[model samples]
Each structure stands twice: as C-alpha cells, then as structure tokens.
Target: MPIYGSASVAESGPQATVRVPATSANLGPGFDSLGLALDLYDEVTAEATSGTAVTVEVEGEGEGTVPTDERHLVAATMIRTFAHLDLAPPGLKLKCRNRIPHARGLGSSSAAIVAGIMLADALAGAGLTRTEKLALADAIEGHPDNVAPCLLGGFTIAYSTEDGAKAVRLDPSPRIHPWVYIPQVKGLTSVARAALPERVPHADAVFNLSRSALLVAAVSRQPSRLFEATEDRLHQSYRAEGMPESTRLLHDLRTAGIAAAISGAGPTVLALAVDDAELPEAPEGFEARRLDFGSGAEQVATSRRE
Candidate 1:
C-alpha cells in the first residue's frame, strides 16, 4: 500500500488533512551530517467545498505573508503532483495551520513539498511508496534530510544521489532524549548553504568525511557515542556570523553538559537533554518534545516537515 494513503476517502466528509513535523538539521558535527525530526507540526487540510476557485486559507507564521495564488509553494507543488500523476485537477480548499516556525532550520519548505506529494497520493489515488514520494519531495527541494523525516517520521539520516536517496529506518532508542531550543528569530536555509565555501582544502574535507562516517556508525550502533558522534567541520560554525543567537546557545548547551549542535543548517539547536528518557521533560519555550516513529507508516499532509 502507498505509505501516505488512507484506507478510506469520503467525498462529503471533512477535507483531507496533512500534518508534517518540524525538523532540525546538521546537528553540529553532523553538518549536512544529521537531522532530528520533531513533534511540532505544520498542518494542511484540503477539502472539497462548494467551489469554483481553489481557495487557500493560511494561519500561523506565514499567514498573509505567503502567496495565495498558483505561485504559492503549496498550490504549485500540488499542481505539479497532479500533472505528474496525470490526474484531473481536483479543486483545492487548502487550510493551513502551521506550528513549525518558518526559516528556522526546521524544514518548512520540506514540509510543504511532502504535503503536496502526500495529498496527491490520497486524493488522486496515486500509488506511491513513502520512498517514492520522498524522492519526489527531495527532487523538488534539492535535498533529502528534511523530506525523509517528514515522510517516514522520527530521527533520520539520508544519503542522496542524482536519482534520489536511500534511508535506513531505526527504532527510536529509549536511551536517547532530544532537546530542541528554537530561538525567537527566523533562520534561512539559503543563508546557511551560501555560507559554505565553494571548495574546501583537502585536509578539511577529510575531517568532514571522518566525522560523517563515525556519526553514521554511532547512529546505527551505540546511542552512547552520539555525544562524540555528531560533530562537523563543514558548515555550522562558519555560518555563526549570520546566527549569533544560536552560536551563543551552542556555547550554553555545551556548558550545561548537553551535546548540542545546529539543527539542519540551523538556527535551531537540538541536544540530548535527558539520559534514559525517550522524550524530553522540559516545558515549551525552553525545551521542545521528541517524536518517535510508532511503526514506520507515517502520513503527513501539507505541511512538509522532514
């Protein structure tokens, strides 16, 4: 069965809903190293209404700031999905209630991309596997770290290629606890990416490879090694000039005995907050919750959180 599909589709019920989770990428040593998917969501519901025009209503951070026309990322991606699947255009009544902070290295765009692909699978009955949809979402977004987590849910590591990416599924270990701190400012992925040098010296390049390889091994085996596993020489620290607040937070996290790093090209810092607690014990605005993959069949609508 297509991973994003529902068992039943009611023509006259509530509009189909999609909720994608927030993500923090590049967890320090893990530069494009690693990304942790969070429970915060960006939700999108599309229902058939008495309609001629495809009406879109948006709330939360983006609000009226985003385009409502075909230019909007949501509308545009959905339209693209329909064309790809060769389905007749189903008029969209898109209502978005977003909790994932925008431009905060939490995969807002990835969420948008996955949301469209998921909707196409459900509405038009396109038979798409989670991996298939992930590939499409990654292709549209130019990366997989964000899109993979949204489609599959939970902590994710993706290996991307010209064709697409292949991802490994790991059970959320009970010994691992993720603490996410989102500051009160927006962080742009473009700025994070552009901050990287066009080419690195061979020695520095080897440093990244060594850390990335060890990080992958740690993620697969010793949850204990994550403290040493997820470090990077590639990007996060260099982008610090643009995101000083996060840089300060990183220092604070390390001082507090927490293993913290930039989350997904970050402006958000995700750390291992508690030992032996699968979820965080702290309150919101100080610490964010951790999400685990219940059984691997995760469905996200609109809202793409990878």
Candidate 2:
C-alpha cells in the first residue's frame, strides 16, 4: 500500500491549499534561462470528490475565459500528476483565486502548472521535496526558467542538463526595484516564440552571454550597471514584430536611461530601478505597477472535515 495515498477515494486525506507566485522570465538577454518571482500570486484550494467529475471555480483573472472543468490548467496538471504518480485519478474540486494576468508574458501558465503539481502532491500526502517539485514542474512547462522561479522563488538561473532541467536560486539585491507596464493587449508565448529565427547570429549569441552574465552580477551588486547589463540582441527584437508597442516602449524606456525589457514574451514591459525610482509613465493604454521579488510557495491552510 502507498504510504500517503489510499486505494479508495474516501480514504484520501484533507484538502490542500497552495499559493504560487507569478514570475517574469528572460529578463532581456537571458531568454529561457533567467527568471524572477513576483509578489503577485494565484491561490489554489483542492480536494478529492466523489465520482469522476472534476469541477473548477475560478475567480479574479481568467474567470469565464478559462475552463471550469477537467480541461482547466490546474485540473490538467493534477491529472498529469496522478498519471505520473501511478495513482488512480479521482474526482476533484478546485477553487482558484488568481491574481496573475493570463497570457501577458508574466508566467501565468507556469504558476498554474506549479499549483496543479502541488495540489496533486498535497492530496496524495506525498511529501515532495523542493527539488522534486522543480523537476516535475519544469518538465511540464517545457523549460525551467519560469517554473523554476515560481517553485523556488527569488531570482533563478535555469538550464537543461544531461540529467534533467536544473536551477540555482539567488536573492535579488534590495536596491533593485521592479515595475511592470502592462498593455491592454496580450500576446501568446507560442506566437512570440515562433517569431524567432531557428538560428541566431553567433555575434548575437555572444552579446546575450556577455549581457546576461553582467545582468546577474549587476542585480547582485552594482545596481547602476543594470542599464547596460539588461541589453539584449537575442529574442526581444525578433519578437517585436508581433508586439510593436511593447518593443517600442522598451526601447523608449531604455533610451531614457531606464533599465527596461520586454517581460517574458510580452506586451508587458519590465523596468528596474534603484531603491524607489518613480515608474516612468506608461504608454497610452498601459497600466504600471511596482512589484518585488517573492519567496517560494506557501501553504496558507490545510484542513480535514471530520
């Protein structure tokens, strides 16, 4: 018999509630490699249900737009987790209080993926280690950049190894202040990724390497260096064709001596400052908000209904 699971649904333990942080990936030159967790979150509460119906209730972001059944991301993630764990899939009731915006290049999907995996593990009473969670979430998300930071929090550098996807987490400097300018429009990751050339110029690759290293070092110590360190020649320009406003705003912000970059595959622009620089005014239809690096996922509550 399994230590944390039972053969019958009725014997499965209490409900599990998980809060996962939002993340910003790429950070200009570190495409698919660098990410930082944000204070925004998506909270999920999941529990086993009788029969095979999977019901999902979504509030806040993506309310009616997202699926409310097994097709829901959290539910799908749970199903995938169940399959991976070799456990019988059972009915589920999931309530999602989502604050992260969907499809805006802020790692919303990655948060959902992490939430699902956590929910499954929690329901099974499988005490998955942080490493285990990272591995599973990375595999599901197809890259470690976004999911890594979402799972471990702080700033993360991730890459695929022969063994598997792995990441190292670092705390961002207290002096680095983050602001995001979100446009009314949204862009799809698949579309943005598809816009890239199969092969980038070798010089461009070298440019990213130099800048990405500088970015990490700068964010760690020299806050002033961010203006130069966050420069990119890899994917930003390439992705701009689909989101001209985003790229234009990024260029404008940088031209004004503000360290800015397209957030993830964005219509959202990420700007970094020292301490508390006033966020530059956003373009006509965009909204700007200040954010900070976040700690990892938290279990706010767990309860058993007798």
Candidate 3:
C-alpha cells in the first residue's frame, strides 16, 4: 500500500471543483496499456462540511441511475482518499455533472475515480504529486490505462512497476482525428473480460507486440500508418460476439482503410483517421461524433478557509 504523507492540513470548509476527461483504453493492440483522453468530461464539486453525512447531487449521464449517497463511486473514493491522508472531514458534499456515457468504454468510472482523488487532495491540501495520484487512482480502478489518460491526458502508455503505476504522456499527431460510435445499449467490462480466452497462441502475442509498438509511433508522429498500427489479434475478436454492432462497425471502418478498434471493454468503437478522411455513417442504435484529444484533469476552483 502507498501511504499519503501530507505536510499540511487544510482548515475546515475547504471546497474544490475538479474536471476529469473521459478515456479510451487499449487503442488497438496495447491492451491494458494504451489510452487516449477524449474531450468528453465529468465535473465534480466537493465541499467538506460540518457533520458525518455524505450528500451528492448529480446532473446528466447518471443523474437518476447512480447512487447519491456515500456508496456513489466519487463519494466512496473521496472517503477512502481522506482516510489515506489520515484526515477526517466531518462530512462531504459533492455535485457531479457528467457527460461521459457509463460502461460504454468511454471511461466514465475512471473519470469518477480521478475526480474524487483530485477533490480530496485539493481540499485536504495533501500536495500529492501526479505520480502519487496515479498510483492511488490505479489502485481504485484496477488498471492504469483509463486512469492514466484521465489524469495526465493526451495519449498515454501506462504500465505497472514495483513502486506502482507509471505512465508516459505523448502529444498525439495533430493530423490524427478521432471519432467515436456509442451504442444505445451499455456494456459490462466484467462480462467482456470473461469472454476472453485464457491463453492465446504465441504467434498472436507476437503480432500484437509489433503493432502495439507501431501504434505508439503512429499516434505520435506517423499518422499515415494508423491504419496498420491499430491492428490487433489479442482481445477484440474474442469479445466481438457480445457486441455485434460495435464489432461490425469496427470491421466496416477498417475495411474502408480507417483505423478502428474497440474502445476499452467496449460496446463503443473508436475510429482514427488523418486529415480529410471521410468516415462512414453510424449504424442504427449508435450515435457518432468527432472528438478532440483531451487535456488532463484540472482543478477548476477551490475555496480555502482563512
């Protein structure tokens, strides 16, 4: 376990507003490692109050569907983060405005987790470094791919180390444009993971290894190679049966020479294209839109007691 050591404690009634971006993980062959932050976002405002109750107000995305109590993902993460800092706030109030679609491989959960950690850190004046925050977020989310881009933004390559999760951020090529296709039905990451095979052939492993490396170069500098760099043999095909529409769309886009892949444990498909490339229309039951690469999570506002 990583310990959070705070040099200073904030006064009571500290409040902070944080905005975290949605992330797309496994951008092709880099399963559990590659991620890109999207312009879609979830914003949270947190205030430390005077009692033990936790209250949450939500708008958009999961407004009525998600829990509004401590059981909520952001609230729960905040509570845990406060505990780690050895600071006990009497109570907490959170207001969440979400735009990222849940369980559609757009990283709604990662955004929530990052939002909570950032809010707690800002309010408590914990002064945790970005590395520390990444470790904490990765622990909560169980992987660094989504959390990495949600925290650091841009294009990221995340990996685990003995110390914790670490990542490198790279600016994506300006010429590469991204478009997402979101489905009306939701996806469950757990179900998708269960659909994967325990062992793949050695040749398949080698195939993904080469493309994953190529994907890094393609995204960073060689936009022309994206179509080839995004090819994979590790996860998508294995999970395709569960998401026919997404899989079919991915296939259609790729066949037309677009770089397309499943986003995270997706029912959503992410298509990458360079300048002036025309993408096909979204299939029925899906909504499509172009998105810019996102910047990292930011603390939009904070109120500190005198």
Top candidate by TM-score: 2
In terms of lDDT, model 1 sits at: 0.67
Task: Write down the lDDT of every candidate, Cα atoms only.
Answer: 0.67, 0.87, 0.91
Quote the positional error of residue 45 for candidate 2 in Å.
0.3
Clashing pairs in 2: none
lDDT of 1 by residue, 1-306 (tens): 222222232233334577787776666665552566667777777764333356778899799788876666776787778777765455567887888777777788888887777766666666788778877887788877777777776667777876687566555556666667777677778878898888777887788777766766665566667666666677776888998877887776666666678778777777764455343333333445454432222454323221
Candidate 1 vs candidate 3: which has greater lDDT?
3
Model 3 ranges with Cα > 4 A deviation: 1-11
Error of 3 at 67 (Å): 0.4
lDDT of 2 by residue, 1-306 (tens): 242233354454368899999899998899999999999999999988766788999999999999999999999999998887887767788999999999998999999999999888887767878778888888888888899999889999998877667889988999998898988898899998899999989999999999999989888888889998899999888888899888788888988889999999897899998876766787798999899898788777877665
The candidate, 1 or 2, that scores higher on TM-score is 2
> Model 3 clash pairs?
51-90
Query: For every model in order, what is the number of clashing pairs?
Result: 16, 0, 1
**Candidate numbers sorted by lDDT from highest down:** 3, 2, 1
TM-score for candidate 2, residues paired by index: 0.96
